[model samples]
Target: MSRPAGTKDVDYAQSMAILRTRFEWVMLIAFLIFLAVVPRIFSPETVDIINVMAIWVVGAHGLNLLTGYAGQISIGHAAFIGVGAYSTAVLILQLGLNHWWALLLAPIMTGLVGMVFGLPSLRLKGFYLAMATLAAQFILTTAFLFAMPGIVGGISGLTVPFPEIGGMSFRVPENLYYLLMPTAVLMTFFAKNIARSRLGRAFVAVRDNDLAAEIMGISLFGYKLRAFFVGCLFAGVAGWMRVCYDGCVRPDIYPLMDSIWYLGVIIIGGMGSTMGAIFGAIFVRLLHEMVLVASPALGSFFPPEIAGQLGSGLGLVVFGVVVALFLIFEPRGITHTWEILKGRIRHWPFVFAPG
Candidate 1:
């Protein structure tokens, strides 16, 4: 005799849960292996790009937590990243601290700062909250620019020393990859864990319906603030990595446009999905690199002066167009689209009405 429908659904859910858990383990192992041999398989330049993609994955995971899970909209994530990067520079250069100590402290400081800015979430929602954070982007950048120029390095920015431990220095992408790749992996693991935890569920509840979540005894204000703190903490770590990688921290490094791109990352990947953050980071960063390569070639078609100007503008234009396309066609982001594709492939040879 056939199983009851309810029993079949329970079986399906259990099987899916098991499959997903196994898939995550497999992917983590594969990614770690990829990092291990990345320098050997790719050119140094490509390896550098891969390193950057990993760092952005860290930042995007944070944004995914805040905007994706908690339903908060922010356009100033780069500010938190800036805070982290600058904090690292300040701590190491001014306080004469080691890179390891600075690294440990930067994210905590950024998270605290993020919590302060996140306070407005108690009274604001939607566009107003976005504007408030947008204001934060300007406020923080201005502080870096004009507040303590001598200490913060002002408009000139600060140089990050090559991170060294035990008299061993890391000055190459391959070397730095050893430190950054594992950090990214660990943070990604944490994000996955958070998504499955009680607090993560609380975040989802608030995102879905604040009033209902509050009625269920969830604290909307508290959860929202915590979401911002966690998200910004991720951005801070990414910023610190970038500073270490490039050996510099500048006000312009984490600009408004970059903040928009982070939002685009989660949107393109899939809101509220950890895998979505990874997919989004890879897709967006690769697209960025391609634009950089293609821009120079396209310049040949125009006068040198005009070409220089056009090349400068090409990245933003392309990014805007791509974001618009996704918003229109795949608002649920790449994760949802991938799921649909998989479903279609599995159920091939079946047809249904276009509901």
Candidate 2:
């Protein structure tokens, strides 16, 4: 039987939706396959870089969820990561807990701590909220240092235990890479799904206009707190992975500067995007490492001490300038560019889809 025009339109829409969903899944599967086979193709040094990129991807995803999708700026995200790292370290060292169990609990503990700090967000906005989060960084770091010198070892850092899986230790970077990669991929998937859900819409609505969102029956207080909790959960996972990779957890490891670096990753990568988090991490980490590698070559012309200082300082300056340029010119980020390319490929032989 011939369908009516309206019914045909609905069928077309549903068919397109299915096609888009399948395409997304196919892309994701292909990416995972590539990652799984990467160790076979790359040198160990390159694989180490890939592992670091994976860790940063997790941290960037956490920051993006809070500041990008939810419009909640956090200058002290690394503090929450520290909380997770220390919690895992303490559990393994002091309590003699299994590494796997400690890793599982780390994020939950960090999320609770994040919720406590996030309470201030109910009353604060913009700069004030950012300042409040920054305060969390100082207070937590100082507390870990002077307040409990015996426990956290003051200036000296606490050693982290090697992770064990199936009675085998993961001491090598390659082994740790395999351990971290799955968690990173799962977290990225989770973030993407959440961003496509109703909760994501609520976040954007509140971000655009809190008053209007509240008027529309969204609970501003509830959603904001949930966002903080979820965001910190990702941070905790990242921290747990960091401890596994480095085999140590120090209070100084998560400094104020580290927090600033994370924020920079999200801005340069693209806010409110899962792909942005991954792209930002890879771009920033690779750029930093490239500078370090080129430092000696650039240093030959200058005195040793001066070269060292200039190389480090110039690298940071260049990083800042790149971020500034991206913010001003490509605020939507590399993800936006990727999207345009994808759209063009998908609609070949057609000018463009009507808005």
User: Candidate 1 clash total?
Assistant: 0
- The lDDT values for all models are 0.86, 0.84
CA lDDT of 138 in candidate 2?
A: 95
lDDT of 1 at 215: 95
lDDT of 2 by residue, 1-355 (tens): 1222223324655544423355567986897899898878888888888888888899999889888988888998888898888888888888888778886898888888888888998899899999999999998887767766666667786887788878778887677778889889989988887887888888888778999999999999998888888889899999898899889877788899889989989888899988899999998998889888888788998999899897878778878898999989999887888777766665554546423
Q: For model 1, what is the alpha-carbon lDDT of residue 103?
A: 79
Error of 2 at 148 (Å): 2.3
- TM-scores of all candidate predictions against the true structure: 0.90, 0.91
